[model samples]
Target: MSEQLIQLRQELAENPYVTFDSDGNGVSRVLDVEWDFHALNQNKKIIFFGRIAEKYRLDIQSYLYALMQWQKKNSSSGSHAPVNSLIGSKSQLNILATRWGKSEFSLLSSEREWKKCTQTLHGVGNKGTCKNLASVINAMLKAGLVSRYVYKRDYIQWAQPDAGNGQAIAFPEAIHVSILKTVVEFVETYHPYRHQISAAMEKLYTYQDEMFNAKLKELGVSALSHMQMNSLRNRMSRITSQWPERKAIPNFSFHRSGVWLGTLLRMCFICVGLFSAARKEELLSMNKESYDDSLAAVPKVSGVSTKGNKGERICMTWNTAPIAKLALELAFDATQAARRYSLKRLANGYQNGLLTKDKYDAKRQDLESAFVSSDIPYDSEALINKTSLKFHIYRADDGFNMKEFNINATTEDVEEFDLLNPERAGSLKVGGGLPKLSPHDLRRSFVVFMVKNRLGNILTVKYQLKHRNINMSNWYANYSELARTSQLLMDTQLMSEFNEAIETSAVDAWDEIYNVSDTLSGAEGERIAQNKAERLAQGEEIVMSRSELLALVRSGDKSIVLLPTGGYCTNRNCERLCSLMDIVEAPCEHKVITDKAGKRLSRERDNLIASFRAINDMGDYANELILDARKKKIVSIEPTLVKHSIPFDSFNDDIKAIWS
Candidate 1:
């Protein structure tokens, strides 16, 4: 083993969490094999075990490398290392360690072995996993633990793209509208008596323990039997039957009341998630002080984004609609008993000297978290799990009859929903069950709705989604069904935007031909220039407003299609299927070449001339036809370049020497 590898192994033996900084200061991360990423709000841990811990031990080096890289990244920019990335790295490394056995980095040098190992991972079907594994291997290679030649040859040459897992489908428009309407109606119905319902729930919570103890004492037993517990629940329900908020609460057993209230809380969570486009962690980390509507016009929700803030919890604020304010209020009221129970426990723990000051402070911060599990005898520290949250969301969805709300899905809506969900396609009908919902689906649907309606672009939506880059924002908004359907059903505002885009293109073309360029090319360009000259002779300015150009385009007197070759094609009825390669060769009379097109032509001419010279320099007789075709292409671009006063080299004696 190399000296660096021996040192890394020794460090791992001493401390599992050791990481070195620029000043050689050792910083420890997690002290256990099962890392708890509490800041990430994940329910699971990144566990290293079995082969990763025993025979192979590749995880030691890979983990050390990941920590160093994370520290380097954090030092350069204040971006947090995502727990998901670490989990993915651990998973991929475990697979590699299992496949290669004790050979480890020795087997990685062989291209055949690398292919064999990577093929086994193809079934994993995650491009991010492949990237994670590659990052660790590359880091090892840079640290001189693996051969650098293998890094350049084998690792870079392999390609394993994800076939997609189909977890990112956006909710259809009909379902989205129905969910919002259902949540809004439910919140409005119960919001008026929120205080009374909270008080009643608190009363039920307080009486449950007292009644249970009293029943145990009366039965002369320490614990109640199954039948005894059921009888006590009935007695407690009868006792609260006369409460003023009985009508507001759902009709359920007193012990199962948390199920109904939890559903209400999840509905409010959905409302905030949908309107604000916040991630699941950001939404779950919200506290009582998260929402503010003092400005009335622009209400905002505050939370910490742990994704890219360099391991520091940076507070981010999202502007939301007024309905989000109602959702926040409803969520606060729904978790009232749970919050009270948590505070009471914290107070008792601190007073009895059971908890240190730091632990008490940490638990106190959790007390203010807006969402929690609503089980009776509530878990003060446990957040709601995905399964229970989805179950309640589904229950709320199934209970809200779409027909009563007059929500009828159109044929297009059903077709769009099917396109998004191919496996369950044709299962959604006009009045059938709604598709399964997830928090991510709401986020994707939000992006699709905003982009499809032209409310914002991908970059603007990135801020709302809390994405680190525009690429992820693009992925969330990649609803192909919406894009395909939008063309067939363009609304008036969309059509106007389309027309405005065309007018803007035409105005830019005309502006270049009249104001910027001293001369122009093509038949249409010459005619427009002569017309502008005559107008100037008659003491009239040639400037035109976008509205006037839009009128012309709408009236069918003018048309413009911006070409990829940096010019405009004005012949609306022309039948030439021209491409970038053959654009200069096309004999279309309506082509208009402005200064921008002239510059583009000049660059193309230079590139063609360089290719011609390089091929001729090879001194091969077989290149005659290729050289002739490229020479003609270069010749074809010169007229437009010369007409617009763009300078270029003519084929003279100096250039002809290459053809010798």
Candidate 2:
């Protein structure tokens, strides 16, 4: 993907609805949509003071002015008036500091006041929070807003560095690919008809119009009643029955099983996060109408992404992965429904509920302006709440009743609560039972599976993850390198068995690996058998750790490679060596045989020898077909029998000279 597309995809991953709360300062605040909007705003303050404050007053008017008000509210909202009222007034700043008890910009005449200011900070909060307070204080100093005049170095305890660098927590933890796949499957099945439903809606409006035109041309009739239209549609359906036809009915697993709507919604949330590899904020907060089916009728999710930019498209799924595209469509579908519901609910509360006309109209006007101002094709009554998902509160009692005054519930309390504390009706059995998964783990699972399905192609994973840098994505994928190596070894074992069945003409011999055949081995090889072979081979150990195991596998030494599976080496060349990092990890066709591998061949050779001899004794005059089949089977098993150690000289000159 191009850089522009990657950036767009990442931005599209943002949650669309901006939930707002007025912090008693006559300005609304947006929360939970950005990971660290507080710190992000703080950084912006630094730049605006140093370079942009005076130079770009227009830009600062909306952003910087609002930020100061927010900071003031955090410090002294209960007792004080608005923050801007005391901006350049030193007397008001001091009075504000007294009411606040501890302030970042508290006036400090002597050295003692600054020390006391920091002392009171740590007393009220832990080191972690104190660190944040110290940071804001420092910003005030740089912005030339601080009245404190003291040595900055003396505030050592309060201004100490964070506990650790954020590197440890940089990359997200991914769930198993199996669990993720199951979640995706559930989401797809749960809302399988979303696209069909949308298409049916569009078709409903246009099909009648088209039908009238067709009938007018063919039969000289221009109009049809609703009954006639229905009849004609049914007839068209029957006539096209012999040809290929698309059914509008849902044909997914959930429809058959009939899962609850809440469970379906929860799965849809997870599937979107897991498949998109988007940050938690991106998944939880989505545009009320994020799905666009304009691109060849495939739904593409679009939204405002909040990773280090304003109003940039965060992330989106392309035509590349069908499963991902479907997951996003369902999540967006839920969002569309939720937003419409919010609008109707809000308007009803304003019109019927006990509220002043002015208060009701304030919210009504806010929503109305959104529809009028934006390019989003919302009807004049779409309430895009700060949250895409909403949970209704209940009064504690013997009976359930939704809490009252919910119409005025702020964004802080009106969260997408289903993901946080989802009600469980069914068990996932991923591990023990599935834990209530966080949104971030879904993103991690997305990155991890992208790496796995591509077999450790880091670049492909990075692009899919939409990582700003490769390091974080690489850390997430490579964290379980040992696990990937273990899979490689398993692949080798499987391929070995596959080759064994092919060479010996016993097609079901390798069926033991899958335990599918009647004659398949249950516990094929005992630990004692492995131990005995190891003792005979001079106690050579299996490579264990990731680094050592990877080195041994790639060493290109005859001793380095283990005979985990039976060898099928002939026409082997030393020039070709396998890399541990390569996507193809199965046994090479031109494999080289070693002493340890010979042990497996010897055991197989004895089994074949016994079977051939027994068949020969019973088949002298049984039938021509049986005798010919047994002979051909013996011939197929003979070459591998020679590759293993045998009495070559004692055999006839024909066998001895066959090596040439």
Candidate 3:
């Protein structure tokens, strides 16, 4: 071994491959190399070059090919980079043992013997397999028996790890040789490496899983169960579905129109995504100002705008230019409308008002906004202190407000104009506000259009979607394709249902009737007056107005207030309740134990006192009232009685029949 090393060192001194002044060093490469030969000598490093040294008898080309094969088979680093496994000489030697057809490399003899029957033929007993194998191969290679074939693991080729199909057999060299050849060829030719992509995604997912597992374990849980995985499954499903479709570029301008705001917004978002692909925060924070100066110089726009900071080589397809043009126009229109509204307000002098400009109005009034109100041409100088003159008009004319105008429009004038042309607003139904659509829908529609058009590079498409990775971008490509193929739009069934529910739940009418009861002189009114008088005599007051009284009587303030005993309000100190009438206006199931004067139960007694026991059988509305589930006592109560006065017997009886 010493003689071989001496000869090898002498040969290395003049060998062109070993002596070249690589990396701009004046010294020969052999002397300049930072390779850990000394570390190898001290049994601290594995010299991987040793494996194929004497395995084949051939010329340098054959040696190179064989070395490449060996590297391909053994290398774990995905790209052409070596990873430090820190395997010492012993492990390399153990690997060499297996390569040379050794049965096992045992570090612990007693344990090795104990598990001999269970061990496989080529399995190393955790002894110094890695280091020993590397050292042996490297030594032979140094003696000129083999050439080093430097290669990285073709992770794309070996997408899935071979776990050897459970049925054990001797490791086959032929299979590895064939695989190595294919891996090398595949790497040389760029192709869609589905397996490799899947592997990378899996590794990332595994890392995320590990982090979550650590968190769960720290919270005193063992391995996660199916329930926990299921909880996250919905998000995972979305991610999985999204992954394959991210990289498809669609024709963003194909569906350009006056009505598809959702489509337009989607295109703008995608353009923003493309420009600011790497900065998620910046992309999200982008506003009209982002496009000001950089794009304003172009002949298409009138004002300066700025966009998020993007790299210089932000590639845009020809199709993108039109979409960007439209986006800028919309942004300019919004900015202009806002500016007009602000100017009108200033023209009228300061007055308490709530308008669209208020949300982003922070700067000094001197700095006039480039974008002004939509009515800049006709009513630029006019001012209104409320939502808008148009919104008022809509309320008066149509009897309902359009909600979309609230989110996107500057004033009532804008709302009225939009509603007047329902066909222009994508044939949206006229009654409700803005047709239940959102700006995000436009983003989706734009991507779909882009996919339909096939207007950008695959990579460009992915970046345009603002995907964090190529995999995500690829997934978006798939989604774009699906959207184009399907031609679907936003589903609005739920929105319609929601509007219906809001209108039907009209408890406010009861409040109105009670409001006028204060001036009543009829027989029923006299009865109410008498009730108020009796309540006042007992220290209770009928302080609530007629409208308030009716609301309390007919409707349950389900969210804010509760009726404890069928009709009496439980919170006695609640100012909303009229303590004068003891009529409380509202009904509740709770009450305080009172004295002869009908004053509240004492403070000490109050602490001990509680309303009649109530049990909600199911859902939000209380159906059954039980004193105690174990006792099965019949609780009794009157709907209008105070909560505390209701007996458990009556309380249970009234609720039992309804519940059962």
Model 1, 518-537: lDDT tens digits are 67677778888787788778
What's each prediction's clash count?
Answer: 4, 18, 110
Q: After superposition, how far is residue 12 of candidate 2 from its true place, in Å?
A: 39
Cα-based TM-score, every candidate:
0.62, 0.37, 0.19
Q: What does candidate 3's lDDT look like per residue over 1-660, in tens digits?
A: 244334544554553232112233332232222222221111111123333333221122122223333444455641111212222332343433343343222211234442342233234322233233434345335434433321222112212223221211110122212322332332222122323322433333444455556657776875557787556545544554444422322211111111222322233443443323322223323344444334433322122111221211132221233233334344333233234434455544433343223211321121232212222111223333221221111112322122222333334323332333222333232332333332232233334345545755566656554444777445433444443333322235766675445433433322321332332222233344466566667875444554554354345442122222112233435554333223323322233221211112222122222322234333323533332321221111122123223222232222233433
Q: Give the range of the ten consecutive residues with the poorest summed lDDT in model 2.
A: 398-407
lDDT of 1: 0.64
Better of 2 and 3 by lDDT: 2
User: Which predicted model would earn the best lDDT?
Assistant: 1
Q: Output the TM-score of candidate 1.
A: 0.62
Flag regions of model 1 displaced more than 4 Å: 15-85, 94-116, 139-167, 215-244, 248-257, 293-297, 350-359, 376-410, 418-435, 480-570, 573-660
- Give the alpha-carbon lDDT of every model: 0.64, 0.38, 0.32
lDDT of candidate 2?
A: 0.38
lDDT by residue (362-410, candidate 2, tens digit) is 4343332111111121222333322111321111241111111012222
610 in model 1: Cα distance from truth in Å? 41
Better by TM-score, candidate 3 or 2: 2
